[model samples]
Target: MEKQVNAKPGTKQKKRIKMNMLIDNFQLATLTLPTIILLGIFAYWPMFGIILAFKDFKVPKGIIGSPWVDPIYKNFQFFFESQDAWRVTRNTLGLNLLFIVISTVAGVIFALIMFEVKKAKYVKIYQTASIIPSFLSWVVVGYMVYSLLAPQGGLLNKIIIGLGGEGIQWYTQPQYWPLILLISNVWHGVGIGSIIYYAALMGVDTELFEAAQMDGANKLRRVFHVSLPQLVPIITIMTLLAIGGIFRADFGLFYNVTRNQGALYSTTDVIDTYVYRALMNQGNIGMSSAVGLFQSLVCFVVLLTSNFIVTKVEPENALF
Candidate 1:
């Protein structure tokens, strides 16, 4: 009590404010502590493994003890020299670009459609139905696709035969896979994706919508001028983030859904699947790490470039 009384006015007020802040936010801090710790353990801690990209890792030598490659970039050079490099890179960029465009459009459309559902019970039902597929494992989805597309006794083949058309070999044909994968990807993701936009729509100002209606705005005009403008920030941020992962692919979706058939490699193979195959077949830690690091670097550069453009075009929506 004496010490508190003796303290300078500024110091005492500062200490009291600090103490009050700590007391107020203590519960919030407790809630986040576990997440922070887990993020450190699982996400941040393993960043040290990035060194494997430069080192010739051996089982006996381990990460730190392994010798660095003579040329340092030899592993990266090996990947770039491989003939599949161009093919995988092209497919990764092309397919990811396609997914981003199609998924964004589909998600936005779905969200808009959902927003029109005024009945709470129906909304819940629709949301549950849409989100269920997102929770399904890709392996399960692969089998489901197989059951439909399998040449022998497949439902789709049976339908085709019933229609007087020949049963098509769906798996071996690369041409049909781009469309099949797109549909599968959209079906699996669009529901969850739309949920984000739907939440954004929920937060939109009711007064703006009311004002739009009063000014002779129809439903379509209101959606275009009011709803879409409100969604621009989130859409920009999501697209920017998606662009960062353009060099990567959903490993399970590509691997399991396609069953890793060599025939589909021309259309379905991506950098992640390629590196996974290389790692599994050769067990070359350095090469795989190099590919991962390359992907990261490309993603980082793309993200920065995209953010720069957004910052210039729409400073408010830019992430950083």
Candidate 2:
């Protein structure tokens, strides 16, 4: 057998080896072709439209035919100089930060709590209940919220009148919207976020928990020492990803839930809603494109900075 193996391969062996490699490559290419085509059509193709941001766009002139801004900064200048800039920026960042914090903490807590439930049936039921809201469109959620907050016939107002108190106009009041939006966002988002943490928790090595128990660690101690530490990487990755969209608000949530009420713009207006309003009211595609480009640039910078910080603090957890 050794002598036979040492013998030089004939032309058939060489051709078969080459044929197998060719077939493997063909299979890989075939599997990936659709994805490549999709990316080329949707992602890479639309990226060329980014040039519209720097052009003084006119529908008659088309994208390529449109004249460039006298100063490339003109579109950006219009946005930054507008009175809506500060308010929208503040609303977007503040609400997003609040949502991130609440979601992260609530998600982790829920996951840890779920981890302790011995019955898989109860865990599944709880998870399903929590996650169902995530599947609901913001339009549906908006109506649900409206029913609970409508001034004349809302559930809250009914309860208030029953208690000898005046019914609150929840939508008209800007002061109450921060709380409302926070609650709305958390309620809609926490389930999906918790599912992420739950998945991370599932991957924790049982041996770590066993070792902790061997050291006289109780359940809470084991979770704190073993479970939490194991989860830091996943948590860091999720936070970094969230940071990329810090400047972008959920349009459906902000627009639909607020009913686009002018009175609520002070609290609910965000970069996304502002862009939509600009496009609708002014029909300035360039301005809208500029806003979009600005959002993309800011998100990119923030994501990079956040990733850098994570790398410095905890290299292992950093998403490269």
Candidate 3:
């Protein structure tokens, strides 16, 4: 009988493969380590501060050593009891909803118009012009609005007076501010929103449009039937995301644009501004954290619910 020998001649190749995998993992870690470390330090690590919501948090005592309150519901109770709570919450939700609707509709219209521009040079210039406002800080935007609407010397008032019409009280009137806030927000914000939708529109296959035109479809027919239908999924997804944050508002826009005027609070106040004022006036960290946590939880639930509804209606558009 021949002597039987058991051997694994492939052992060297197996070892080499293991070494390659280890090297690949090390490379991945090296590439991603900085981001991971920063997020751990800034985002996840600081989450321990959530405990401040439950404690009678004293900056003096620090978050950990601070005495925990037996009940934290009192903070929320005090908030809900105030008339400002309902007013701010309503304004926040209402104004954001209006912004979402108006900005989306206008942005899509502008994007389609931009897409139709035959001159490429003009198209680039138009795109550049549309996006310039988005680069400005909200503080700057607020000042721009002030320059345009200042009752005493605003551009609009000057124009109206020059045209022999009564110059309106541009800032004091609550009736006008809702319109001003909406328009100003759209003016400052629509550029970015339009750019996104325009980018998406640029990605669309022109073959669809060519085919529709070949079928003797007019420009309006092609746009309404083809272009809009293709953009619906993205529109739906964005709408869902915006709806999730309905409880929040743009702090700077409402705060600065309204000049933080007390009278304007009826129209411009929102959850963010209210919370900021609470922090400034009372220096109550736990109370402020409680408001933040409440807003976050509501947003989380809304996102899930909205995504579910979108999934049911149009699975392709659902975020999840």
Candidate 4:
């Protein structure tokens, strides 16, 4: 410029601060860039396939070129009209609700027990052992369950025989599946679930516990007042997230664990397993997609409604 304009000292300082802030933000963005790209490629890209739910998908025709169903809702009608619809829906909702309640309670109790250990090394050992099961593939877990429930040579049957009781045909009986599934689900999941609650417990204020001790509170009393109360927010958050997946079932658990036996289908058949069977047996992609989309919609609505209620009752704990 022809004329030199003098800049204020405060203006230079503000500019420098803005520049520094921008640099910090840039560094953070660079660190997160890989994650963003991966999510875009895997998660967002597959979203385009949602169109298949409406289309009468044909192998010869690509997704975009496929003809839309005649009634548009025809694919959805196929599922709703099916005889197994009510059974699968009920099993999905019931089993998931049961799993949520039991797992949450078990996790909390385990965490509390771990918290009382006092020694860091022992706590680490316990945590590592518990978490190991969560990493095992469902296929491996299925085989383990099979070994325990096999008709003749199964571990449980051997024990029953030892006790002079008849060996039960575990797989063929639907009546016993509900309890068996529940126990297996809790065992496999409780470890990882407890870790979450335990981490939250670690963040509790020590001063509160100290105050409780000073006020003549016993261990149980301190747990109820000091620890459980501290966990309410995190519990609320986790429960809300769980609610979002209420319409979905763990496909592996219901499928692999039950060995996909027709007899067990009465008690264990869920939307996910039903869709998988339909796809494998009938090769009806459109109907399967419709059920999946319906599940997603139901889950979304439930999550929003639950969040709304929580917001009204306890604004701070609401996820949104």
Candidate 5:
């Protein structure tokens, strides 16, 4: 006896999808062969060094022949017992948090203001000018800042002195560094962030704005009722990404801005700078790796928790 047939939707579409996937896989294999080999050679092959986190890494013997340890790891103990650990960690997290907040807010506001700017010529000019700061090397920026902010014969100081005001020791004053770092971070980074947010803003449907306008909604009401609501998903995801770096400060911004002053270490030092100083001062490879591992674990936890909260509140906005 002949069996009755059951019709299914999208069987043809599924067949096409499978065929396309096979074609894509074949093309990717051709494109990625060299890259995969390179990563295997230089990237994955070097992962063996990760064992140094467990071993007592000696410079002469190197990772391959290094001795491993178990009872109360000295690398970690040495790091913890030292006072620099807390200072560096606190500064790192604090400065990064400041950057995250200031950059996020300023970026969004800049994007909003850019959106309000009508002329395309002026918009592009302003946008270009804003993002130019982001492209400069921190070293160049540091010198430029020093040229402007230096106390002895510096531009700002010269102006202050011209006005008969006292010349402040900009580098020595720890109280001012935090504000300077915050402003510098925002100024350097906000443009790139604003561009991201502006791109997201452009994706917003114009019909919503039109509908709001018809209901006697002014620009302010339209923004609050239409624009901000549309922007929530983009905002949340961007914020989550920033939070992932809460434990990782921009090394250049913090270290360069402070001019690497030992006296400013309390206010200006961060995880990256601390690791740098540790390597410079202590020359301990194993301990540096351990500190890195600790930072990664904390950032991982923060990212996961933020994602979890986002999923509960707005599943659409959750990155995962």
Candidate 6:
């Protein structure tokens, strides 16, 4: 009799727990529904088209019915064995590495300076001014760059002429593009890039800085010891993410900004622009798809390798 009564109570508790779990699941699903739909629509669904890389990919045969490459890697072989491969690879890695270093350093500096500013109005003004370039489209930026670099009447050439120097043909010269691209990329990206560091900076415990001040740490000392250390994790994560894109390039920056000028291809032509040019010339969907797939695979490998290194060095900061 006593056991029978306890069984009823235990059964009721189980039912209540089950009901609560169902309700919690419903709430979670409701919150996640939109995100799941978007990922399906934009991310996962597009992956179905990856088969195009191996296939000839004609419109009549469609993605599924298209015939695979003879060697199953013909497209990749063509790309790697081509004369432009070394040049494009070199340009892509060189520019991106340079960009990553310069932009990260500049963004951190800008964020640190901004975080130290006490006046809200001044902070707002500085932020607004810095971010203006990021808002401008690449097309507009191309025109602006042209105005500054044009051989006939560019501001830079004009300045050179006034200074008793020869007017440099910037677009036609590959030697100058590394510096030009670096400056242009940094100028365009620093504003937006700094925002992430700034947000991370805001999250740092104010008490830590106060303690550092009490310990007789000057502003520069505090920056190096306190702010910079706190920023290391976020910076590491961002840099790791950037490493994933080392094989890629900003199409707008390399293409539109350079006016797709063949002369600048020596320094400016990257994997993206090279693939684009190849696709346009050959009109081969499979080749273009192969390039995209190659980029993705390389990016994935880079991300995994970088994350693995981070995990070994700083498990807490590693992005798994």
- Candidate 2 lDDT (Cα, whole model)? 0.91
Q: Write model 4 residue lDDT over 165-193, tens digit each, in one string.
A: 99999999998988888898888988899
- lDDT (Cα, tens digit) per residue for candidate 5, span 1-320: 77658646488888999888988799777898899999999988876766776777787887878788664376677677888889888888887887888888898889888988889998999999999999998888888889988877799899999999999888888878888888888878888889988888789888988999999999889878987887788889999998997888788887787789887788898878888888889788888877776777899999999999999999999999
| Candidate 6 lDDT score at position 67 | 84
Task: Give candidate 6 regions above 4 Å deviation.
Answer: 1-22, 25-31
lDDT of 1 by residue, 1-320 (tens): 25565655598889999999989999998999999999999989988999999999988978989999989899999999999999999999999999999999999999999998999999999989999999999999999999999989889999999999999999899999989999999999999999999999999999999999999999999999999999999999999999999999999899999999999999999999999988999999899999999999999999999999999998999999
TM-score of each: 0.92, 0.90, 0.88, 0.93, 0.89, 0.91
Native-to-model Cα distance after best TM-score fit, residue 158 in candidate 3, in Å:
2.0
Cα lDDT of model 6 by residue, 1-320, tens digit: 25554444478888999888989799887899899999999999999988888887788878887788899998778888999999998898889999999999999999999999999899899999999999988888889999999999999999999999999888789998889889989999899999999999999999999999999999999999999999999999999989988888999998888999999898889999999988899887787888889888888998899999999999988888
Off by over 4 Å in 3: 1-35
- Residue ranges of candidate 5 with Cα displaced over 4 Å: 1-20, 24-47, 70-72
How many clashing pairs does model 3 include? 0
Alpha-carbon error at 278 in model 3, in Å?
Answer: 1.0
Q: Pick the winner on TM-score between candidates 1 and 2.
A: 1
**Cα displacement (Å) at residue 134, model 3:** 0.8
Lowest summed lDDT window (length 10), candidate 6: 1-10
Tell me the spans in candidate 4 whose CA falls farther than 4 Å from its real position.
1-22
Candidate 2 per-residue C-alpha lDDT over 1-320 given as tens digits, one digit per residue, 9 for 90 to 100: 25565778789999999998988799787999999999999988999999989999988989999999979989899999999999999999999999888889989999999998889999999999989999999999999999999998999999999999999998889899888888888889888899888988888888888898999999999988888988889999999999899999999999889999999999889999999989999998998999999999999999999999998999999989
Q: Pick the candidate with the highest lDDT.
A: 1
Lowest lDDT block of 10, candidate 2: 1-10
Kindly give the number of clashing pairs for every candidate. Answer: 0, 0, 0, 0, 0, 0
Ranking by lDDT: 1, 4, 2, 6, 3, 5
- For candidate 6, the TM-score is 0.91
Residue 237 of model 1: what lDDT? Answer: 91
